[model samples]
Target: MPIIRVTSLSEPGLEVYGSLTERQLKSFYDDLGGLFIAESPKVIKVALDAGYEPVSVLCEEKHIEGDAKDIIRRSGDIPVYIGERDLLASLTGYTLTRGVLCAMRRKPTVSIADVCRDAHRVAVINGVVDNTNIGAIFRSAAALGIDAVVVTSNSCDPLNRRSVRVSMGTVFLVPWTWSDDYQQELNALGFKTVAMALTDKSVAIDDERLKAENKLAIIMGTEGDGLPQYAIDAADYVARIPMSYNVDSLNVAAASAVAFWELRNR
Candidate 1:
């Protein structure tokens, strides 16, 4: 209910929305889980519904009743910063898609074991640093019946602002965590690992043995170079999505969708 107008770019309590870089925000609290921005009313509502804690909200004054009304009401006593579109854009360095952004506190990341506890189908990203592609893959994983996502520590953060926005907020819909030894951990849990690569030993995605496994971990690699030799070696099965016209490969995000659907557990 404390609706404060943002009259200056340097106004107190506004840094989280503008001044801090994603890295800075992520390190804002160390292990306590850093902060992230959820843009637009719909995405903000989704994050809130997922039990993410709202730190504060920044919205255009025009949305006071028009678009952000319900979000504001649901956010309860958090400090709400209102400003004109022009002034607000100057503070954040870009126009918000739906005239609102909320800063939310990140929850502690769980272990890979906890993530795959009851999962039959899981998607794992290794060294994929593209925020947009990472977001798109998460969207596909959530919608295509993949039960969980596990990202290697070298992969891009799913909670990055651009990733969160591009995902249409579905990033919060699927359970995910960061891991360094994903292959080892997953193997121990009885998951058959499938590395989407083009090695000589690679099997087609529809290989019957793949779909027969009750627990699977489909691993994707970086954009420039597909999976590393070591990752492919570590995998229980090296597989490739069938391509035509000698195309040889799909973008990691596109490949992920094809893999998730074809390898999905019935």
Candidate 2:
């Protein structure tokens, strides 16, 4: 094991776990060559099962003899760095949950076309900035059989630590891509773009149009404002989820699941 002990919070070796903000962590941990911090043993184990390589692990010293020991035994030759609870807390800037964290290398990213080429249905993002929503959408996308996810450069970082954790690490399981010219690419691909909107021209969520086509892309917008006019105008189809008497719409995350469930082939 290449384990190194850190008696002080400022130890240089701790930078891998200490210095970066969640956004920086996402970029760093991406397949482009950086690492991700997986909190909680179960989530870390999930990442490992998905073939992520662990650089090292930090855990409360007390856990070393208990739960941590068993987890490490299965980690093969990976080093386990042990520290007192106070020291681990200071190093990570938060109370350690499950008393374990694993730093793993990011896997390669899949291209938008690669993710979509085999997919019959996909979810496209315009500018949903909330990390939690981004995470939830991925989780729902995976569960509802959405083929892929494409995010504009301006969207929330999908690999954000909070987003990864919120998604139960599903981000690693789903294939996603980024688009600089999001609309043009979809247009050229023969996709029937369906923008989720509440406008009168919008069709019902269960409209036959959503199911009629094999290649479909559902464009979702941020919370405060729905799809921008350009995104709406670019849609090959516009649709809205049905709601009760006084309700206008569901939260984006909730609405996404409903839409995906309705549109996904049975």
Candidate 3:
């Protein structure tokens, strides 16, 4: 429990918590490994529970003995950097929520086959660049019984700072991996693809036929453009959520929640 008082924003060991960009922090330990900053005690706890190694922690002085106590105890011997409230806020460029953050080591990337090997229900995040939506989808997937999540290379990283916080840490709870050829790999794994898209031939999300499938993969697309033509064409069924008020579609995150809940295995 080495506690370091951070007197200045430029303090040598505080880079990961303040100065470094997400990409820089990601590559911080490249030769040894990569790192990600987890904000809030709750999210940090979840990451720890998921076996993500901790590098260090930053805390506001008040929280050192408050919300951050348990995190400090769980952190073992890692350096716990503490600073006055205003100083920390200035350093982080925002007010700390629950007043704590942790720098965690990223795990090795898993393959699509590894993630979907025995998955009964999966979700594919295809090129969804918005971190908030990506996080929300993972949160929904976890809540609604999705076994795993596969994000295409172009999609936002589930471990992105905002995504992790927005998901309330479910990103760590769910098994996920990157996929270059998501469709081909899912098909090879024996999953019937259900693209969440609007098309003439699309079926209702709650169609009984969807629930009848042995293994299902729900494919979700970007915010503005929706699923690509190839993805729609490749899917066994293109499904749409029934809407009211003349709404044509739901936000990707909202639609994902509905689709996940509706198509979840009984």
Give the top-scoring candidate (TM-score): 1
After TM-score superposition, the amount by which residue 206's alpha carbon in candidate 3 deviates from its true location, in angstroms, is 1.6
Distance from true location, Cα of 95 in model 3, Å: 0.5
lDDT tens digits, residue span 113-194, model 3: 8888989999999989999999999999999999999999888888889999999999999999988688888889899999
* Candidate 2 clash pair list: none
TM-score-superior candidate, 1 or 2: 1
Which tens-of-lDDT digit does each residue in 48-92 have in candidate 1?
A: 899998888899989979788998888889999999999999999
RMSD of each: 0.9, 2.3, 1.2
TM-scores of the models, in the order given: 0.98, 0.89, 0.96
Error of 1 at 180 (Å): 1.1
**Candidate 1: worst-modelled 10 consecutive residues by lDDT:** 24-33
Q: Distance (Å) between predicted and true CA of 200, model 1? A: 0.2
lDDT tens digits by residue: candidate 2, 51-126: 8877788887777777677668777787678788888888788888778888778767556667677777889977
Off by over 4 Å in 1: none
Pairs of residues at least 3 apart in sequence or in different chains that clash in candidate 3: none
**CA error at residue 32 for candidate 3, angstroms:** 3.8
Clashes of 1: 0
If the candidates were sorted by their lDDT against the true structure, best first, what order would they fall in?
A: 1, 3, 2
